[model samples]
Target: MTDLAPLPLSVLDIMPVDVESTPSGVLRATLEQARYVEELGFTRYWIAEHHNSPNIASSSPTVTAAAVGGATTRLRVGTGGVMLPNHAPFVVAEQFGTLSALYPGRVDLGVGRTPPHDPGVARALRVDALALDFEQQFAELLGFLRADFPAGHPLQKVAANPPLTGKPSLWVLGSSENGARMAAHRGLPFAHAHHFSPQNSVAALRTYHREFRPSEYLSSPYSIIAAGVTVADTDEEARFRNVPAALALLKSLTGPPEPFPTPEQAAAHPWTAEEAAWRDQFLAPQVAGGPDRVRAQLADLLERTGAEELMVVSMVTDPAARRRSITGLRELFGSAPLPQGLAL
Candidate 1:
């Protein structure tokens, strides 16, 4: 058995919308917190892409990524991921290529297989969603970014003032066996979304490592397990904050997406059977509570997955509380790297 110190941890926040007011208010809050997350010593800060959702402030990861990269020094910024089907290979290459040129070596472009939102937005991207396979599309897209394709390939080559020479390290984000296999087969790093797909977490990790194939980019497999995390000064406080986010998610999936509720509103709505089950299933693997509890749980999950890295997401509704949750995580893990100024 290897006796090594634990792997490092990072974070991915969805750039959540504020419950208090306008979308711009939420955008401002998200940008401010992105900088704060960097100060706490996490590695990369990622934003997810969502459409037609007021609750999620980040609908355009490329734009949000630039804002995040501009605001933070030393924090690797990129999409937690950008959904591939919603965009063309060339456009993705151009957007992220420009980002890489602007902030070389500190950008990550994780690709997800899901359609951006639903049937409608999928139509809007102007692609035949059903005709293309995501895994195949991802491969082609990465090839373009690496400049491995023919000079006059149908997809136009990105002509940035200073082009990105090589591909940024790619991560395959998944919540199932197929995703694990895809990442492993390509020898790219895998990030399992235990926060939302808790039931398959262990199984997915196992499949990833077992099927891993070595390639030029990776000599061995690398995995990052992301989980919903909320930490506080006390267990009670942590649990209290956890409710609003969980309720927010449940409301969206079952009912309609609504603005985040005040702590009072969240506390008032007693959990229904389905909501309870949803919370338990989703939060089953989450690392929560005070420092001791969080540390122990995180350590255990890392040990179980044998992952090279850990990616955490704090789904709290309050900005200050969310900041605290991230700060507390770094303190618990004791792995905050110093924040250096931006390189590119």
Candidate 2:
């Protein structure tokens, strides 16, 4: 008989944008929830950076990671990731360098090149007028973060004071071909954004593995796939609950952000035929069903991608339900049972 493999998983704690009824309440709830999951044996807790959206409050991953790291003992805290094009290479090195120092052996640096927020916001963050070729910039940024750079060189070769002794693990996050190439060349871990860019995942990951070069950090290509999931007691209930959350997200992307609607309200609402098709093709692939469904789907996804890890992004209304979905997932993986006989 073939030995059963144990899959490692990490939670991508979304600083949810729909905290209208309780402003800053979601943030507080998320913090509390991360602690609970840590006790449940999760491998890591990574927060994402989203700007100009009412649905996601976390815009600075370094700061948020610090808050999360402070609350948990063994669970790793990191970015899902930090938008590198918006910040200077030196600044990023210094910030993450400080984080590595403070946390010491518990910090991770997952960097991405996309402009996470709106274009107007991107303009506000950029220091230069030239549009960045993220692949090249990402390559250079890698050099800055490590001590591998030669001395007496221009760019001041800031030898990472305290010398980056732990060598904070680095992962390159991406949703496209350019991103795949960069990660492969650097031999860093690659994270695919299946949650948003589902269409590009298969092609991008294949490109990464084919071109990967051996580097000091990794001898072979390693990858993590990030996806959006919603779970509940029954497949019907999961579908019922997931609609509003999905609708809220679609509205925010197409229109101005507004308060989250009740499940009934979302069900009653109408969507254009075109939008419906888009959602099915773009969003459905990333989302899976309840316990049995998610397990089978996730396992199949892993088999197809050969991903080393699965980073889950749960988008549900109530904080407890969101936590339950995560808990349900753990049980589905056969790692542990959900606390309190939770059904979802």
Overall lDDT per candidate, in order of appearance:
0.76, 0.72
**lDDT (10s digit) by residue, model 2, range 1-344:** 22124566677876665534453787778788889878877777888887766666677788888888888886778888888777777777777777777777777788887763566776777534366777666656666776566666576556545345544588888999778898898777888998888788878888988899988778888887888876567777767666766678677776887666766877787878976775556446755666667766776677777777778886665787777787777666665432221000
The stretch of ten residues in a row with the least summed lDDT in candidate 1 is 335-344
Tell me the lDDT of candidate 2.
Answer: 0.72
**TM per candidate:** 0.89, 0.88
Instruction: List the RMSD of every prediction in angstroms.
Output: 3.6, 4.7
The segments of candidate 1 whose C-alpha lies over 4 angstroms from its true place after superposition are 1-6, 150-162, 270-282, 335-344
To one decimal, what is the Cα RMSD in angstroms of model 1 from the true structure? 3.6
Which regions of candidate 2 are displaced past 4 Å?
1-5, 127-129, 157-163, 272-279, 336-344
